[model samples]
Every structure is written in structure tokens, then in C-alpha cells.
Target: VLESFGSRGQDLSTEELWQKVLQEVTAEELRAPLHRLCALQAGWWLADRRLGSITSLFCLLRQAEDTGRARCSQGENKLLYLLKAWQVPAEEASLPLVQSAEDLKETLCTSAAFLQGLLELEAENFPTAFSLLKEAAGGFCSKRVLAQIYTCLGCCAQRMGKPQTALQHLKQALQVDFQCLPALSHAAAVYHELRETDAELQALALLYEALEKNPPGATSSNPRFLMQTELLVCTPVLASLLRDRHPSEVKYLLAQRCLQDGRVADAVEHYLDVLTLLQEGPQQQVPLVGSSALPRIPEVFLEAASALEQAGRHQDAITVCEEVISRTTDLIPRMLRVEEELELPECPSPGEGLAGLSQKKENLRCLAWRAAGYLHQGWARAVLGESKEAITQFSRCLGDLLRVQLCGSGVGLTENPLPEVEVLQKIRLLSLIGRGTQFLELGKHKEALLDFQHGLQISPGDPAAISYLVLALWKLDRKKEAAAHWLKISQSPPREDEQVGRSFPLYLMSCLQQAVFPHRESLSSRLQDYL
Candidate 1:
């Protein structure tokens, strides 16, 4: 009959099963299954609206406890504590069940301390909870119980502002049970507070790995079901912790790892997630991990644009660049308008003075990033054969790059006054190279030659710049000069693995091949040697 009852309970909804047990099962038949059900449900049954029936069930459990049944004492104490924690109203008589901890502890094992610790922890009394958990830890031989005790201690320490202590407790929890999700989650929070980003990510990664190992519905047993449900509940907590903290930086790092591991699709998804957050701001009402600073949004966008282009999503790459362009366009004009409106005295007001100077510096930095974005957009357009549009983009890029101001020697700044100067030079060289390539494709050999020469002045031994210079010279019928450049290129040392041809597109290489050696048979015979 007990086996049949268990089977029937499994087939019914939780509420329906409890109703059936209350209506048809006799008091003597209820004790075992009710205890089992409470353990399997993991306190979910407390959320149901049938409070009166639940209270009556607790009353029966208390009666069993009074009869000196140790198991019943432990179970009744747990249920009563859960009820109090969740603020569920119980009969006045049942209140004594929670206060009967001394009697229960005398009968049961050290779990009585664990139960009291959990109750105090939930009630936000950290010191008492920590002491009780510490006392309980030595008495448990079960890894699961020890893990829970340590995890609770970690939580208590964290709430009390002892991050180092919290981390130690969480580490001990993992030492006991490496797959403890609560321990991992708390460790992640502690790591974030300590500004140890790599550790935080490692903890989060292990947690997700553990969740994947035990997927939902992998088993029909009560313990497995409860664990699966707990995993589901904890998943969102991970996401929330990430979003509340440096989400953009975390996603950016993850994207780089994915790219290194040859997971291009995953990298693109992570990059896009970073862009979306920066573009839309964080979702409303999500709790932050700590006092997180804004991420480097523009730099992240530039990287995502480059990654998209590498993955052959040219149009998407162009769209991300356009976002940078739009932001800069809106920002620069507003900043200029504000600067004009704020009249400066010999000594500016403290608050406004610092804010105005900071804003000006940020505007300059944005201009540099905006120019780079345009350069990337031009390259993307050129790859798609839109030479006219690509040239226009490159022209705009050059204009923005030239507008950036270099810090003067007398500025009194301790940091490198012209931090953006290096960025400007690199973008200028790339802009010249891109525009020159477009000119070469359009048969404007003299214009292409001039552009290539200018880029060479910035980077003397850059292979792409030299190769294009050779192509331009050959196109303009300067055969002698072209041969001289080719000889110089042949004598140059091989580029290091990391520095080789990253900025040079393969299509440009093909174009250079055709222009340098017009005859098909000559190109085929020399292609392998040149490459």
C-alpha cells in the first residue's frame, strides 16, 4: 500500500498529492511519506496556498516528535524553521516546535546545529549563524552536509563584510564538494569584490559545467529532481551577478577565449552581447555585484567589428561601425555646444571645472576611436567591391583623424599628454593604405602611388605598404623604381608570426599579384615563390 501511495503521489500535482494524503491517508500512514515528500520538495510545498492543511501536517509531525522519535524531531524542526523563514502563518501551538531545539539536539545528530544556523542566517543574524555553523561542521561526516555548512558560513562572512574570510569558507566548501553550486556562486561574488576577475570567471565557468553534467529529467528519483530544480533557480543568479558587475569586460574576455579556441560562432555571440549591453544599457532592476564601473565601450565595439569582419559578416561589421559613427557625431556637437555655453572665469568652480576638463578629454578620445571605426568600415566596404563608397568613408576617416589635437609640451599633465597621438598615427597609415587600394582598383595610378608613399613614411618596412607601393609603381610604368622596391622587399627579414599581414586583406594580395605580373603563365609560375 505504501508503494502504491508513493506511485500515485508521483502522478499527481504537488497540491493534489498533498490534498489526497490529507483526505484519504490515515495518520499512521502519513508519517513516512510526508517526511519523504518534504525532503524531496525542498521547501517548494511551503509556497502553496493551503496553509491550514500544512499546519495540521506539522502538528502531526510534532506529535511524532513528542513520542521521542529522533527522525521525526529533526524533520519537524526543519519544516517549522522553513515555515518561519518564509513567513508562513502556523498555529500558535506549532510555534513551540521551533523553540524545542535543545530537546531535538539531544536526540538527533549535529544536524540540529545546522538547522539552527540556517534559521539564524535567514533571519539576518550573522554572528550567531557563523558560530552555530562552525560548531556544526566538525560533527558531520557527510560531504554534502559539510559543504552546506561551509557555504552557509561563507554567506554569513560575506554579509558581515569579511570578504577574505568568506573566500576561505567557500574554498573549504569546494574542497569538500567541488560541484557545490552555492559555494561557487558565493566565491564568484567574493572574487568580484576583490577585483580578481579571472578567478570570478573561472568559478562561473565551473558552475555552468557542473549544471551541464546533471541535466533536468536525467532521473526520476526525488533527490535528483530537487537538485535539478535547485540548479534552475541558481542559473539566473549567475546571470544576475554577471550583469550587475563588469558584464561587458567579462563578455569581451570570454569572446577572446572563444576565438582562440576556434569557436568563432561563440565568440561572435559574446561580442554581440557586449555590444547590446553597451548600446541599450543594463536591463532594469538587476542587482549589481558591487560598485562596478562603466566598461570601455568604444574599444569593445571596435574589437567586435573586427571580429565580425573576420567571420565574413561584412554588412554586420559595417553596421557596428555605423553605431560608433552615430555616437561620436551626437556626442561631439553636444560637447562643443556645452563648452560654448559655460563661460570660464580665471578660477572655475570646483565641480564644473573638473567635469568640463574630463569631458573634453573624453571627446578627444572618442574622435580617435570614431576615425578608426570609419577606417574599418571602409575596408569592409572595399571587400564588398563598393569602391566609391569605400573611398568616401576613408576620406571621412582622414578628416576625423586630422582634427584630433596633440597635447602641447606646456600642458602640465603628468601622463603622456598626447595619448591619442599613437592611435592617430596608426589609423592615418591604415586610412592611406585603404584609400590607395581603392584608387589602384579605379586605375588612378598616380593618386594610388602618392597614398602608398605617404603610408610608407609612417611605417617604413611594413610589407603591405611596400607591396602596394610596388604595385602602384608598376601600374604607372615606373618599371625601374618598381624593381628597386621589389629588391628591397626581398631583402627584408620575415615578419614574426604575430605581426604578419593581419591588416592586409587577401583580395588586395590577389590584386597586387595581377598588377605586378600581368601574364597569366608568369603569375602562376611565380605565385608559389612570392607567397
Candidate 2:
């Protein structure tokens, strides 16, 4: 009958089932299956989120402590062990049942202290939790439990704002149980806070490797106990673990950090790994949490493109840009209009439903990302010396930028464009410069001159624009104007923040037909000397 009860569905409450077991099973028979049944029921309650039922069951177990203490059967010990491991609270009553041996008594005391530490941790009483956990660590317990105690102590120290102390406790956790992924995660976070980039990367790499080998939710060898995942899901640390330590998220962080620190090849590799992981698994949305959140998928693709471009894999960069374009183009609106009276909200409005206002905001985001895709593709094509193709791509980028219409006659966008509009201005400047460079490649000096002059209007004294403008004026035989601009470039104190390298004009010259701009190097030298 007890074996049959295992298959019972949730239609019958665990408490009611317990009463039925007591009525049908004799005391001798009950003792055999009692702990097993309780463990099973506790899992069911946890799964259903009926934490109250779990607490009630824990109370019942504490009530039986007096009767079970003298016997100290293996059944009772296993039950107590699992209950504590699951973080099911036993009221501050009699000590949990264990064999009467001195070693067992020490273990029992440790169990009591561990539970109390967890209770204090839950209550956000860090000092008390730390003290209790420290005390618990001195007694005999399973290595898993010892690791958990150290982890809790580390968490307490972290909460108390002692990161160095927290790391020590966390290191002890891993020392006890090398498989303690949570300890590694906390250590990584500490390293990040300390601005130790290499240490943080090392920790993240270890965490990712560990998670891949023994992925979360894997079946445990000890079936009698709940899976570690089942217990962890209920805790606040688990929330942080899921938010900050997910495998794909970890890869993305690795890629982002690599990119920031100028590890272009590594960044591309990590970003590609993240993209592949996302494809094989469910797409992970960027969490809205600040700083630590993963970037949206489109943003990741754009970043990957940047990395690829830096690595001189211009064709691969174009391929990822096309991926972004294909994915987001259908979602973008053909036209996006904003009102002058109503300021554009940077975030979604609570009152505005997703189907209405929020969806509109989403569409705008898609448009901007798609435009970015075009911009990157254009730059890649220009770099590869496909000037005509590059001009077409830049024109497409400009077309997407022009879709945004500011609808109002009065004090309009001219007075103060939105921040998004300001970003669009920068993109527009790049597009003009790129297309102007392409025109120069085709020897259309007049058209190229107009583009460079217009680009200078948008951003005056732009080094790249000024350099190209000098080239265009010389090509049109306006040597006086050309010499004057050449002096401007020489006289202008070198801008450390110049977007274009001093050799950019020389690079542009190499990309064009050498015959059309014959003796360009000699002409440049003569002009510099004449100036």
C-alpha cells in the first residue's frame, strides 16, 4: 500500500495522504517507509510551490524528534539529513534525531546550527548568519553541507560589504567541494567588483566549463535526496546565479570583456560561441537589469561585426551584418513618425500596452539596428575596395535613417533632436564620408567635393572629412584652397581623439585608381612644402 501511494496525484494533499498512511500501515511497517514518504512529499510540495505544506511537514518531523531520538535509526538520520539539505526549517525545539554516538551528536549539533544560519541568512541578518555558519563549520557534516556552510558564510560577508573576506570563505567552499559552481560564481563577481579583469575572466571560464560538464538539473546519483537545482531555485543566491552565471550569458560577458580590453580575436570567438549557443537553445532575452544584463541579440551581432572588422575579416563582418539585417528588417516599420508635443519616452510607459506603444518602441529599435547593419556593411565594402557597392550600401543606410519623420511644424527637431536622432546624425556623417570616398574612387571629384563639404557641415573639423576635402580640392585643380586646407591639417594641434588616422588619406589613395590620381604622393609633398 505504501509503494502504491507513491503514484498518487496532487488531487490528494500530502497531509491527507500522510493521515491515510498512518491509518493503513502498522507502526512497524510505517517506520520502514516513513522517511522515504516524507522526502517524496517534500519534493512534491516544493515543486508545486506549496512551501507552507513543506513547513508543516517539517513541524511534524520535529514533533517526531523525541520518539526518534532514542532509536536514532538510519531512516530518521537520512530524513533529517535531507530536510536540512533542502533548507526545510525545523522549529527551534529539540535537537534532530541522530545515533547516540558522540560523533553523531556532533553532526546533529551541526545540523541545528546550519539550519539556524540559513534562517538568519533568509532574514538578511548577516552577522548572525555568519556566526552560526562559522560555528557549524567546526562540526562533522558531509562535504556538500560543509561547502554550503562556507558558501553561506561567504554570502554573509558579501552582504556585510567585506568582499575580501567573502572571497576567502568562497575559496574555502570550493576547496571543500571542487564542484561548487556557486562559490566560483561569487568569486567571479568579487573579482569583477575589484576590477581584476583577468581573474574575473578566469573564474567565468571555469564556471562555464563546469556548467557544461555537469549542466544544471542533471540527475543526481543520490536519488533519495532532492536535486541540488530543486533546493537552489528557492534561494536568493540562485536568483543571482541564474541572472549572472547562465552559460550563454557567461560567454557573452567573456566576449564583451574581451572586446573592451582589445582582444579582438578572442572576442569574435566568444561572441560566435554565444550566438551558436543561443541558436541551439532557446533565445535568451537580455535581462533588464543594469550593467550585468546581456545585450539584445541584434546588438551582439553588431558587436561581433565590429570584432570581425578589427580582426580584418571584413567579409565575415559583412556576413554578420547581413544576419542582423535579415532578422530585424521585417520587424521594422517602413516609416516611424514622432510628434513634437509628445516627448519620446526612453522606456516603455506602464499605462501603454505592448500591442500599442511598446510595440512601436520595439519597431524603432529594430529600425535603428537594421540601419546599423547597413552602416557596417557599407564600411566593410569600402574597406575591400568595392567602392560602387559600398556607395549603394551607404545609400540604403541613409534611406533607413530618413524613414524617421518628426511630425510638427512648430519648434521642431531642428531645435533639439532626440538622443536617437543625435545618434542618427553620427551615422549619417559616416555614410556621407563613405560615399564621398567611393566617389573619389570613381574619379567623380565634383560629387566627392560636395559630399566632403556637406559632411564637414555636420561635424566641423572632422579629421577624416578634412583630409578627404583636401584631396577633392586638389583633384579639382583648386590648389589655393587645397594648400590652405593642407596648412589647416598641419597647423591644427594633433587631436588625440581623431577618429581617422594620419595615414587614412594615404590608405584612401591606395584604394583609388593610381593612374587617375597620378603622382598624388608627389603632389601632396609639393603642397605641404609650398604651405
**How does each model score on TM-score?**
0.48, 0.62
Per-candidate Cα lDDT values, in order, are 0.60, 0.68
| Model 2: per-residue Cα lDDT over 1-531, one tens digit each | 556645444566658666555555555544534654565555555545455565566556555533443333563334344345332323324545322223323443465456556667778888877887787788666676677678778878988899999999999999999877888888887888888889989998998898788776552535223233224224454345333356788788788778767787898899889888878856444454654546677877887887887778989989998999999877877788755533445676777545665565566667777877888888789879999899899899889978877666532324554445545566667778878878988999999999889878876877677878888898898989999988877788876643332222111221122112334477679797766
Q: Give model 2's TM-score versus the native structure.
A: 0.62
* Segments in model 2 whose C-alpha atoms lie over 4 Å from true places: 1-166, 192-196, 219-238, 241-244, 283-293, 339-357, 406-422, 477-528
- For candidate 1, the 10 contiguous residues with the lowest summed lDDT are 506-515
Clashes of each: 0, 0
Best of the candidates, TM-score: 2
Residue 439, model 1, lDDT: 96
